[model samples]
Target: MRIVIVGTGNVATVLGRLIIAKGHDLVHIVGRTPEHTVPLAKEFNCSWSGFSELHVINADLIIIAISDNALLDSASTFHTNPVPVVHTAGSVSMDVLKNVSSHYGVFYPLQSLRREMMQIPEIPFLIDGNTPEMIALLENFSSTLSPFTEHAGDDQRLRLHAAAVIVSNFTNHLYALGE
Candidate 1:
């Protein structure tokens, strides 16, 4: 599968590495900042572009791995893409991507991800699509990256995200206090 990843943060970098490692063609890397985007593109050996140039790129899949706050606004830049588009956001609704493409979905990774991590952790992907065909496509693609993948709707994903936040944050807070 040919893929284009947006954003230059942890999720983008990590996913880009995984996609390439899996023998998938990472066609392009798009982000708002060239400083970050260019370096990442170099690492992946793919073309780089700013958000404004997104429309020209062609890929089988486009993953918007940006932050939750930027998801909706970033999605607006896409003018009805033909390929399937997915976001790695847990809290944001899949509908936020409705206008971005005819086929849109959520590919939320339930586990915490950091670009600096020496080894990739087992990511439990919670995926959802606008249609059954889209869902199947996402599920099939996600399975290649991780063994643990499940279908999760908007409400379920949101709730799971909330719980994950509380658990992770609360555990860290306790450890801080212990220190």
Candidate 2:
């Protein structure tokens, strides 16, 4: 599958690495900053460009792996048709991408993502899509990396993310204080 990864942060970088390792071609890497995007594109031997240059990209899927704050804006920038847009944000809903593209979905990895983490954990995916066909497609793609692929609605995903922050983030902080 030909994919275009949007964003330069840790989540995007890590996911891009996983996609490339899966033997899929990462045709284009889009980001506002060259420093962040170029190295990742170079790592996969692909071209990197800004979000505005996305129309030229020929991809089956476009993964918007950016921060929660920039997720909606970033997703809105992509043109609809040809490639489906999937955002890797647990807190954000599938509806965020639906407004901009007919083919939209959510691919939230149910795990704390760190770029420094050497091994890819058995990360489960909480996926949701605009249509039944889109949902099935996301499920198949997610199943390649995880044994489990769950169907989560917008509210369900947001609540789950809140609980995760409490469990993962707060607990980690308390552990650090104890240390």
Q: Give the candidate number with the greatest TM-score.
A: 1
Q: State the local distance difference test value for candidate 2.
A: 0.84
lDDT of each: 0.90, 0.84
Cα lDDT tens digits for candidate 2, 1-179 = 88888888888877878887777788889998888888888887899998889767778888888889898666667775657888999988888876666889999987888888668777878999999988988988877767878999989998888898889988889999999
For candidate 1, which ten residues in a row score worst on lDDT?
72-81
lDDT of 1 by residue, 10-118 (tens): 9998888888877889999999988999999999999999898877778888999999989866678775379899999999999998988999999998988889965
Candidate 1 error regions (>4 Å): none
lDDT of 1: 0.90
Instruction: Report the number of the highest-lDDT candidate.
Output: 1
